[model samples]
Each structure stands twice: as C-alpha cells, then as structure tokens.
Target: MTLVPPVTAAFTLEQSCFGKLRHSIRAFAGSFRPPQALSLRTAAHPSTSSVIVGFEASTWLRSPINALHSIPGRHVTIAFRTEVSDDGELSAWDVQSRKGQYDKVLNALWEMDLRELRVLRIDGLRWWGDQKQLFQERAYPFPPTQDDEAPLFARAWNVEVLILTARSDVSLLEALTELPAARNKLLFPRLHTIAMEWPRHESVSRSIVVDLFQKRHAAGLPVRTFQVLRKGGQDERWEDLLGFTQVVVHDSASE
Candidate 1:
C-alpha cells in the first residue's frame, strides 16, 4: 500500500505528489499537481490491481473524480487540501465560488461506490465554505436517490481512519462530526482511529474531543484510538485522551 502513491493535483501520478501523501519525518509538507493525462473511459488502467487507492487534491473536481471512480474496487482513500489545485485554481477567489465547486465535487463523490474507502484525510479548513452548510447540500438530502449509496459528505459509514491535518479551526471538526440533513447523526460508524493536528484553536477544546468520543461511544460506535499529531500544532487534550481511545501523541518524526 505504501508503494501506491495517492492520485493528486490534476490527479497527477507524479513523484512530488508522493511527497505530499507520504508523511515524512523531521518536518511538514504541501500540495500537488497533475502529470500526463491518463484516460479511463476507453479501458481500465494498465495495472489497476493497486496502482492508486487514494486521492489528494486541494480543490476536488467532478470530471477527474469521475475518471478515477470509473475503475472499480480500488478506491481506498480520498484527501482534500487547502492550497490551489491544478484542476481550477480560480475557485480560491472567494467563498461563494469555492462553495459552488466544492458542492459539485461532493455530488460527484456521492454517485461513486465508496464501500472500500478506509482512510479519509482533509487538509486546511479554509477550503470549507459556509461553515454551517454541508457542502451547501441542505436541500439535497442523503443518498440522492433511494438506491444511491450514502454520501460520504453526509456520512462516511465505513471510514476507519479519520485524518484532520487542517488549520487550527473547529469548523472542519464540527462538519465531520455530523451531516446537513442529520446534524445529530454521528459520522463514520466504523471510525476507530482519529488523527488530528489543529492545535491551540480558540474553539477547539478538551470538551470537544471528549464530547466527540462520548457521543460515538454512546451510540455503540468504536472510537478505539486517538492520534494527536504534534508536527504542525497540538491539541489541549494531550494527556486527557484516555477513556474511549488510547491517548497516543504522534510526532512528526518518522517511525
């Protein structure tokens, strides 16, 4: 799995994007771009067994995402970065534009089969538009159609690892904890591990983390581990993350 680099940028398959996905020791990292185009409409990839199981794009788009989803059963991870992407950097202009673009990508993701998706990593809370709206999908409810799978934007039921390397903000955390239609609905039913690195946020506190775990535990959800990343920033509940999950402070240095 380590060898399979995350498809990033214009969903580019390049070495630099690998650096973005492959967490390095000692320091930190940035975003990525696309290389040569690799169309999937004609046929499956040359070797689709496990070439890429993840996506790491800053501003996610629908076309490339659709192309990626065309290949069946290999979708394992999907990431959203804060920086400008190769797809359409103009969306960074304002909140309304970002909201529209982000909304479209979420709709595209909704249509895909994401059962095998294990890891969901999101970077930069800045990209999140209209803090209250879940991808501006208030009117658009869960599962689009009765037969459609539950949208990840609404609830990533099978996601095991939830990674939040975003900036110091609670918006992303709050959004991840619930959905637009089901605000009270707990997210990621199978989520067992949470790795976060948004430290010293005025809004983020020990109670927030505790509340997250408590709510999930009360619902019979398994929040077995909490990985506090100290690479960029730190959370206040360093030593306090004990009851529901093992309080493991993860450092930036490589293992």
Candidate 2:
C-alpha cells in the first residue's frame, strides 16, 4: 500500500472528482501552479479583476497587490469589474465613495509600477439611473462614470487581455481618450485580446461606436482579438457590429 500526503491526495482526488463533474476544474487546477519569477516582455505590470457583482473589489487594496510604485515587468493583468457602483445613480454620498475608490486604484496604477494591466469582464451594466417599475416605488439605476475610466485606460494601454461583460458602457472609450498616454494615441498599445459581452439594447445603435473603434484600431492601437458573448436577448446586430474591431462574438444563449 502506498501512503499519500493529505494535501496532495485531496488535491488529486478533487481534481479527478471535479474534473468529471465540472468543465472548469481543469483550468482551476492549472491556475494553482506556483507563480513564476515573472518574465515580462517589457517593464510593465498586469493584474486581473472580475467584474461580477459580488466580486467587485474596493480600490483601497491596489497598492499591496501592485507592490508599491514599481511596475511589473511582464504581462500583468490587473483584474477589476468595470462597474463600481451597485446602482448607477450616484447620490452625493455614493459619488464621494466612488471618487475615493477611483483615487485608490489610479494612484497605485499611475505610479507606473506595472508593465501591463488589463480590465477584465464587466457584465450587467445597467443604464445610469434609469427607472423600471417593478412593484410600486421608483428605484434609481446604476450610473457608470468618468472617474472609473482612469485605471481601465491605464490597464488597457499596458496589459494583455481586456475582458468586459455585455452590459459595459460605450463611455469606456471616452475615458480612454482622456488618458495621458492615450491622449497621445497610445491607449492599449500593448493590448492583445479584448473579450466583450454585448447586452441587448433596443433604443441604442452600436454601429457608431463600432465604427469609431475600428478607425482607432487601424491607427496602431492595441486591439487584437475582440470576442463577444451575447447573453440577454436584446438584439442580434450586436454580434455583427462587434466585428468592426475584428472581435469574435459568441452567442451565450447557444452556449
């Protein structure tokens, strides 16, 4: 009989048992390998954040993760959800808190302590402060703001994969245009992949936005593979429109 270390046994069994039960088990195990002594292409940094609701990270912790004013030299994906606020309409207090969040994330990234940082998936971005009559009382919709754009632009210009959920806003591009590096037309210079999720919109026409993106992409920008997954049945045109950036759009519904 052979004896096995509890930790290794647990891990191996978990891998086996879950591998048969779950599709993501293999990837999850793969990510468990020890982090290497980062070998970066350029002197850059990257961190990845998930944009899912409960996973939204507070900006206060950026420094500890980013290692204080020193940019990571390799591909560092700074992961963050594009949506900062739960409800889009920022009350006076919400705005203050949001600003504080922005300051924390940007100050850390702006230190240029990273080689590359990418903004990952943002799903379920509702219209800023729109009203929907649910039961009786009126409620405020979530508002996406300009302040949230700095860290994103900083990462996009410097990182590898920028993944966003379908509900993300077009305003992200506006914010990119204002970045000091991007203003000089260097936003996403190092970007290789953009994973997007396109939400359905009845009133909004996305062609205008897609056209603008293509023009910029041709001008030496960082957009590489653009992929979109449509979840909510808002429209099918989004898939075609997303192609302007040469992005592949997948139908989440089919998956």
Candidate 3:
C-alpha cells in the first residue's frame, strides 16, 4: 500500500491471518516474516499512490510491483529502508547478500520503468555495489554503456528534483556528489532543484557541494535551484551556493 493507508491497516501488523498460513518457506539469514499483509492493505485501499516501509522492508518489495507491474503511466513514490549498521555493515534485512534468494525482488525493481518517476530521494542508505551493478549488468552485449556506470538516479532522465540526506562517511557522497569523470558525463541531466537536508553541521563539505554545481554549470547542465533544510527557523549556512543557483532555505519545524 502507498500514501497514508487507512487506520485499519495498523491492525494487520499484529496478527495478520495471512501470517499464520503464508510464511515464506525459504531459508533466510535469520527468520522470514510473512509479507502477505502488505498486499492485503493495498488491496483494501485502491487509491494509494505512495508507499514507505521501514522494518522488514525486503519482505514487502513485491507488493508494489504486483500492482504497478510494467505500467509507466501512473507515478508513485516508493521508499523502503532496510537495516544497515553504523560501520557500513548490513543486518539480517540485507537481501543482496543472500545470493539468488531475492532475484525476483531485484527483478521487480529493474522491471519497473523508472523514467516516469519525477523525484528521487536518497538518505544514508549504503547501496554498496548493488545499485551500480544493477545498471552494469543491464548493459549486457552492448559493451559498458553510460547507464552501466552512472549513479542510480542519473539514468532516470525525467527526474526533476533530487533530495539527499547524508552523513560525512556515507557512500552516497562518494557516489553522487563527486564531479563526473568526462565532460559529457553529466549527472541528473534534467534535475533543476537539489535539496540537501544537512543531518549534521560536519556532514558534508561546502566546497564539495559548490564544486558539483560549478562543474555542472561548466558542462551546460546547471541546476537552477538549491535548497537547504534546517531544523528550526531558517539559518544562514552555505550561502556561497547562491553563486551557482538560486538558494532557498526550508524551516523543517513549521513543516
């Protein structure tokens, strides 16, 4: 289910009847949790257009795909966060380490046409090599294409906005904030707005942030707007970003 499902949906979390009968038989790192309740909630609410899951998210990956499938006309916001350790390690929720255990789940992500998505958001989740390899493998029989190496959202050409919430040591900065290797290798080609919710003051360097914008401008693919989200009222920080694009501040308290 997506987009603020009904209150009744919470009841299924406790004792879903589906859990009693439909438990996954496959061996998991620890134990498997039945995901049937996810499908049931979606079935109950037909108007759902957004889906966000946190705990036991891997078990629920199939629910959205089962509904949307290969259709690209309808757009939805899908956010799922699995458990990742503070030291770049994965918890039992990690699906990629299981080999072919979740091939269908990975396929569900690849099969969906990502071009229709308008906003792509990334937090502190460490994708390791999984995200990169996803596109790399798709380039089979074509020598390595740009899609094979570009960051995940870079391939979704239609995306207009990118939101990032990252820490200093997160791999996302290493993967996304860096300048493109080639002059023609522009990232987030159609993105006009970039929002950074600085989780900590020391999270990312201002020079690194400004350099990315400057590089993009030189390549003729400049982002038009940059937003910084702060906890309380608006505060003056990284104002130098104004040199490259219109700077906007968001007061998270009021929101």
TM-score of 1: 0.52
By lDDT, rank the candidates, best first: 1, 3, 2
Location of the lowest summed lDDT over 10 successive residues in candidate 1: 35-44
Q: What is the lDDT of residue 111 in candidate 3?
A: 27
Each model's total of backbone clashes: 1, 38, 2
Worst 10 residues of 3 by lDDT: 37-46
RMSD of 3: 12.2
lDDT of 3 by residue, 136-205 (tens): 2342322244545343344455656655543212234333434433324455577677666544465355
> By TM-score, who's the top model here?
1
The residue-level lDDT of candidate 3 at 89 comes to: 60
Best by lDDT: 1
Q: After superposition, which runs of candidate 1 have C-alpha atoms over 4 Å from their true positions? A: 1-102, 125-143, 147-151, 175-185, 231-240
Which is the winner by lDDT between candidate 1 and candidate 2? 1
lDDT scores of the candidates, listed in order = 0.41, 0.34, 0.40
Residue lDDT tens for model 1, 48-161: 111223333222111222221132222332332222345543553644544443443333333333444455444333333323333223445333554243333454456666
Q: How many backbone clashes does candidate 1 have?
A: 1
TM-score of model 3 (CA atoms):
0.50
